[model samples]
Target: MKPTLVTQTALFIFSLLLYCAACPAQTAQPAPNQTAQKVYVGAYVMNLYEINPDAHSFYADFYLWFRWKGDIDPTGIEIVNRIEDWGANDEPFSDSVTVLKDGYNYNGLRMEGRFFHPFEMERFPLDRHVLDIQIENADYPLDSLVYLPDTANLIRMKPTLRLPGWDIEGCSLTAKTHMYATDFGNTDLGQEPYSNIVLEIPIARPVTYFLLKLMLPLIIVLLSSIGALVIFPSRSYVDARISLPIGGLLTAVFLQQSYSDALPDVGYMVLMDKVYLLAYAVIGAVVMEIILSANYLKRNKDTNLHALRRIEWYMALFLILGFLAGNLLLVFL
Candidate 1:
């Protein structure tokens, strides 16, 4: 009985050892969804390849640069940082706003994260530049979406928008209205393209000043000055007074038209407006001189004779003084 008991005890010990050996290794259980990953997000200036001028819209590719900061390999996951959500607050917008479940399709330079960067225009005049990033927020695990055989979850990465190394070829960003976003990743996963950050490219200062302060306003002023010189200033009876102002106004009109296709339709004045206003003023002066001359001729029988005589000096002095005073006030003030 003792021998049998010893043998049974030995057998039980052996069975326990075998069971332990067959048990799974206590190496390490991967944490639930592992720890969240961190990464840098930004945008880059691009050379526009195509453009659509009518909509004030164009197409340009945004190069995004980023670096991963996590314990696990940052693969098969995507990062979407800049999200334009019309559904927010139930605000309605166009029916064409494009949203990507795993890809992006739309116009304009869109991206997420801070570091305001602007592209050099003249390099790509027609393409809309977009730099927003889209990341796949998948967890790291065997049973997670990443481990699914034959499936790919590209790491969601915000586009890398770096500051210019040496004057980004042909672009510059205005510091005030330049677009940028803060935070590296979307903390919210429930929202599609989830990101609490809203990035906005403010109206470019140079572009705004150029179009409004220089171009469009000038066109308007030039148009208003039309038909002035032809009626105001004429040296000959054969349509000379009417012709120069007409020609000048026409020339200004043509110049204004040349750039009409490139500008957006907005209401504002520009440097061009100042120029046209000046041109109109000159045309008005021309008309006044013509009328004065005609009246002078009728009063004095020989207008040319009066012009060349003592009256000429007085008229010259008055005009010189008037112009000097006007220009001086404008310049000094």
Candidate 2:
């Protein structure tokens, strides 16, 4: 027989109570474990490779070494060169991987790639530059990965290797944390920071190269053009004197353009540009000296000829000394 209304209501209440008792109470989720893995980073540059000042990029060949805990296979961890736009990955460049006596995993990566870097060309051929190699794990956040600089085996450029225009002075490594922001869809990830290891190789340019190739020619042309002022002012050689300084000015302009093409576009004038400006000034002075001396001679002023010649000597000396001083200041200061 069917139960009465009161009985049916009582049965329904009992079932509800049983369901509540069987189910566990809800609690907040535990926070994610933010434990970090220790990784040792080392690098050795085997080749200086190529440097493109116009493009503001460089190519380097180096052996990148890493030692990490064996508990996790860091092979999947992304290795990024922090200072450059180039990417490096595990591509079987190693002959074999080694397991350290301390139970750590070690691997060496043979990396040869082009990296974009902002080259400072204010000094140009006389400049010393620091080429940096930065590495980090892409997948692991800073809280999950910490890079330790391998000081004992720090990054070094081969000593025996000599670059044509550069000399390697020193090498060093530094450890730091890099902070990065994520996209909107990855807000749960929030702003992630990564472990970064940086290797710096300081290279210096021998001023001798610039002295020989650039400064020597400039000096020669300037001296020749200024020498025109010493020639006795005569109608026969008037055109020659004027043409000499003009030709020197044109030569200086050509040299400046050629050198500028090798440098990156910068807001301010470089030391080389300053030197070119000095050349233009000296040439202008020489041209004026020629015209003035010629005009004085044309007027047939024999009494003032010696005075004019003496004045030319002083002006020429000033121009030469001024050019030298300006170049020295730009190079040393």
Candidate 3:
């Protein structure tokens, strides 16, 4: 009975050993959750110049700084909206990291470069735009690091900063996580969001440019075309009436082209274009009126010159008032 019991115990121990070897103990463990580090960013715009709508770019010079805690380096930054210009940009203001009295690491630099912005030209001379400067840490993902706007003095511009033909309305600063669509071929990392800081300057064209430079010339062309109706309805004055409107039409086309040249090609017409279209229609109506009147006089041997003059005056008044009213609606509403 004792020998049989020993044999059974040996078999049980052997089975237990086989089970342990087949299962194997797990050595890999899941990583613990880590809190993302925060980096404070600030900027002071010194100058904004060379704003060119045709090129869809503008030049800016600004001072940029960063404040962060711990050993993580957040100074490896990239200007997301900057256009690459070989050797034209300024170097960093600091050669090494700055240790502040409050136990934070700081670094700063003066940046000068051209930035890209897709200008909305629907309003053209009356358009308003917000020029922005976007900064991102090229090395750190939002999971590991995030940005905080130095709200105390987030965005400051030079007191004397001026952009010709543009009025600076105000400025704003913000920080947010910007996500890229692709994983950048890193399946392990997946699609990571990056912390970004944006400094925006709202600007608008001066009202004088719209009123005097653009609208005034258009008004002149319109008045000149309307003047064609003032000429007397006689065989001798028919050439004058026809030629005046034709000249005004040519001038209007040239004026539209001049402003259109300053803007990029867009799919739809702008407010100015709409105004010019009204002018064209009015001029065309004048041409037709002159032709019809000339035809009527030829068909009837005795057409009253005084009665025809009265009709022409009424037509001119109607067209002028209609044009003015249409312009007001287009501009205001």
Best by TM-score: 3
- The model with the greater lDDT, 1 or 2, is 2
Query: What order do candidates take by lDDT, descending?
Result: 3, 2, 1
The sequence of per-residue lDDT tens digits that candidate 3 reaches over residues 34-149 is 58788888888899999988789999998888889967888788889899666347667689998999998999888899999988887767789999988898798877787788
155-207 per-residue lDDT for model 2 (tens digits): 36676766667878887778877666554378777766777777777787787
The lDDT of model 2 is 0.75
What Cα-based lDDT does every candidate model obtain? 0.38, 0.75, 0.86
Best by lDDT: 3
Tens-digit lDDT string for candidate 1 (48-122): 322232343323333432234334443333333322333111111223434345333222223222222333333
Cα deviation in Å at residue 304, candidate 2? Answer: 1.8
Poorest 10 consecutive residues by lDDT, candidate 2: 81-90
Model 3, position 94: C-alpha lDDT score: 85
**Between the candidate structures 1 and 3, which one is better when assessed by TM-score?**
3
Q: What's the TM-score of every candidate structure?
A: 0.38, 0.78, 0.82
Which ranges of candidate 2 are over 4 A from the true structure?
A: 1-35, 74-97, 181-184, 234-237, 264-268, 299-302
Per-residue error for 144 in candidate 3, Å, reads: 2.1
